[model samples]
Target: MMLIEETAVPETALPVAQFKAHLRLGTGFSDDDVQDAVLTSFLRAAIASIEARTGKVLIERIFSWELVAWRTGYGQALPVAPVKAIEDVVLRHMSGSEEIADPAHFRLEKDTHRPRLMPVGTVLPPVPSGGAVVVRFRAGMGAVWGDLPADLGQAVLLLAAHYYEYRADTALGGGCMPFGVTSLIERYRTVRMLGGGVM
Candidate 1:
């Protein structure tokens, strides 16, 4: 299985100014925006880290996931949470042909922890032999930073601040995420059970 980011978070949607404020950097100075690029990088890194840890997209964007088969014939759980919509599902055959699955036969089951793609009938659409199915969809809390849950927004800031402060600390240990960030994102982590895992 492979996941591809069909659309990325726009720079305009990032909270660069808010991140700067969180760092409490001095204002009204000639170099006020001097470090904006650096801060923005840290913000992006923090957002990626949080998303990786929680399987939650903070910013709205489209993604394409390709797989040979569904996790189950009943339903296929999405890799991320709060999926807003399923744009398309395409079956790609080894013969170089593609067929778009009918949306009427399938539906999106929204869940905070594990959103799923489910069939209206007994089983999901089948993938052609030696072919793959690609699921394209949009997932995220919202399009802008303001739309994020307060705790998630705070977690981003806190983690970004941690990155900014330790920019040059290469010797940092593997478990570097601060306690506040872990606590803030605790509830967002997906709980895997019964050996059910994303393929």
Candidate 2:
């Protein structure tokens, strides 16, 4: 299985000013914007890290996920949470043929942590032998920073600040996350059943 981001979060959707305020950086200077680029990068990194840890998307974007088969013939759990819509499902055959599943045949089961793509009927359209299914959809809390839950928004700012503070600290090692950020996102993490099957 492979999940690809069909569209990235727009820079305009990011809260650079809010992040700067969270960091308490100096203002009114002619070069106040000098650090804006750096800050933006950190914010993006923090957002990515938090989202990955929590299986949630803070900003809205399109994604294309390709899989060889459904986890359960009934439906497949989406990789991320709060999916807004299922745009299309395309079946690609090994013989170079493609079949677009009708949107009416399937539905989106919305969940905070483990949304799923379900069939409206008894089963999802079957993929041909040696073929793949590509599911395209939009997932996120919302389009703007304000659309995020308060705790999540705070977590992003806090994590971004952490990155900014440790920008030059090489000894920190990899995958290092602060307790505060982890706590903030813990409730959002999905609880998997046997071998990651959603309960």
Candidate 3:
């Protein structure tokens, strides 16, 4: 009765050893980090299930534009509009709620670029499935904002799972492995690559 029930196909079972290795490489927490550990486990399982079902990996791009205007005591300071752009490149491979699938994929792609640095008119790389998912994700950015609510921790876990699936898929597809797991991984990698290793 699940949404993906009809389309679910038996997947090549994920190897336990490989899964554990992936967990180690993808996350920085230890087993003592109960919250992170649990979340990571959930993400891995969800990703494995989704990959087993769909032979093709779902790839997506993530982009965002933010315009803010502040007023000073003076004559408005020429509007002072500051435009910031960010991305959260992600791949949604986990077969979970359909609503999340789109957003998950988007976060994967957006994670690739340096926020507020990529030029406004820069061209983006094409994603699988003709970019439909990416377009939808970008359009839904407003909804994904805010603290990922503590009550919605389970939902966050599901999103994390889809993210992991995307990373595995991209790696298998001959793309460079993401810095770690989700867009956060890209953040860490970007910083390190820029010569800002651990403060």
Candidate 4:
């Protein structure tokens, strides 16, 4: 199975100014604009890292998942959280033929952390014998910063500030997430993924 983000969060929705405010560098700090690039980079990194850890997308975007067959007969789990919609489902055959599965044949069931596509009546669209099925969907809590949960939003600011403050210190090494950031997203972390095991 493979998941691809079809569209990324829009640049205008970046929380640069809000993140700066969270850092409390001072309301009238001089040369604020001079550090825009650095600040934005930190913010972006924080957002990406947080999203990866939590399995929750902070902003709404399109995603495409492709797999040869459904993992189980009952349903297939969508890895990301708060999925807003399942746009389409298509089964591609080895002979280069494709079938758009009827939307009525499946229903979306959502929990707090993940959404799933379940067969509507114990009968799901058939998987192609030698090809893959593609699921296109949109997932996220919201598109803008204001739509994010207060704690999650604050968490991003805190993590970004941490990155900015510790830029010169390479003691932590790669992928070592900070304690505070992990604490904020612990509830959103997914325990089990589609194929089984933990995320």
Candidate 5:
């Protein structure tokens, strides 16, 4: 669909290698397979989003070629759900043992009238009754546009998860989740601290 200039080739390579190493060590996935999975997952998530809104399969779009190619290159789809799921998890984490009464209360909006992809410090409204939560996520251009470097893809997914968790915890009445972008930064003192390792 959209064309993106390929930048950060050198910057992305090392992190891609590190991401492969992490996946091998943490999940026992071979580097090649992990790459494929990430790409496939990205396509699936993109397709899911497109299908969710348009009720048409992504295969119908001319952009599907780019997505398919990315999937062919990378082994796994990016864990995009965690971007929103982290919010739910964090809410439950902060809410303690109380069961979340309904899933409908918590909603995840992807790319809703947002001009930029991955706008910084955007916060969604909290659901009423302390039970509902809403989150809006922008799909990465690399993932949505074309082949995203592994490192950048990982970073986007991590941020999605981090913000989701952070916002959800903040929405909760009690203390925030022990792990979030802010907490991880304060605790680990590194931006790369909250990688795809957690979810």
Candidate 6:
């Protein structure tokens, strides 16, 4: 299976000013604006890292996932949480033909941490001989910064501050999560079920 981001979170959606406030960086400094651009990168990186580790999108964006088959006949568990909508499902046949599944035939069983695509009736569309199914959808808390969970927002600011302070370190290892950041996002880590199902 492969998951690809269809659209990225807009920079405007990032709460840079609020993050700065969290860091206690006063706006009176001459370099405040310059620092904002630099800090924006840190915030974006922190948010991306947190999302990667947690398997949860902290901001709204489109994502497409490809799979050979469903985990169960009932439905397939999506990789990301808080799925807002199922954009479309495309079936690719071994013969190289493609068809878009009718949205009416399937529905999103939205959940806070796990969402699944469930067929409306007894069975889903016929599977292709060798090709895969591509499902596209939107997921996240919301498009705006204020829509983020308070703890998650705090975690992003804390982690970004960490990155900002260590900007001169030059040799920090990748995937390094500070204790506080981990504590904030630990509960969000997704636990997959048997047969590649997500819990």
Off by over 4 Å in 2: none
Q: How close is each model in CA RMSD to the real structure?
A: 1.7, 1.2, 19.4, 2.6, 19.6, 2.0
lDDT of 5: 0.29
TM-score of 4: 0.88
Off by over 4 Å in 6: 29-31, 170-174
Candidate 1 TM-score versus the reference: 0.95
| Residue 85 displacement (Å), model 4 | 0.5
Error of 6 at 132 (Å): 1.1
Which of the predicted structures, 4 or 5, would earn the higher lDDT when compared with the native?
4
Q: What is the alpha-carbon lDDT for the whole of candidate 1? A: 0.91
Candidate 5, 1-199: lDDT as tens digits: 1222122222222233343343443545465554544533433443343333322221211110011111111121222321212122112223433343243433333421211112123322222343322222323333232354333344434443333335435455552322332332232121222342221
List model 2 lDDT by residue over 1-199, tens digit each: 9999989889898899999888888899999999888988998998999988888999999999999988787888888888999999999999989989988888999988788888999988888789999999999999998999999999999999998998889898688899999999999987776565645
Comparing 1 with 6 on TM-score, the higher-scoring candidate is 1
Which is superior by lDDT, 2 or 4? 2
In model 4, what are the clashing residue pairs, if there are any? none
What are the per-residue Cα lDDT tens digits for candidate 3 across 1-199?
0112112212222223333454464545575344444545654455433322321112111222211211111111110001122223222223421222232222221222221222122223222232221111121112221322222223334445455556445435443323323342222222223331111
Any idea what lDDT model 3 has? 0.28
How many clashing residue pairs are found in candidate 4? 0
In order, how many clashes per candidate? 0, 0, 14, 0, 14, 0
> Per-candidate TM vs. native?
0.95, 0.95, 0.17, 0.88, 0.19, 0.89
Any residue pairs clashing in model 2, and if so which? none
Q: Which of the numbered candidates is closest to the native, going by highest lDDT? A: 1
- Encode model 4's per-residue lDDT on 1-199: one tens digit a residue: 8989999888788888787787776566577778778888898888888998888999899999998988775788787888899999999999989989999999878766757888999956888999999999988889898999988997888899999989999888788777887788888787874355212
Give the distance in Å from residue 69's predicted Cα in candidate 1 to where it truly belongs.
0.6
The TM-score obtained by model 3 is 0.17
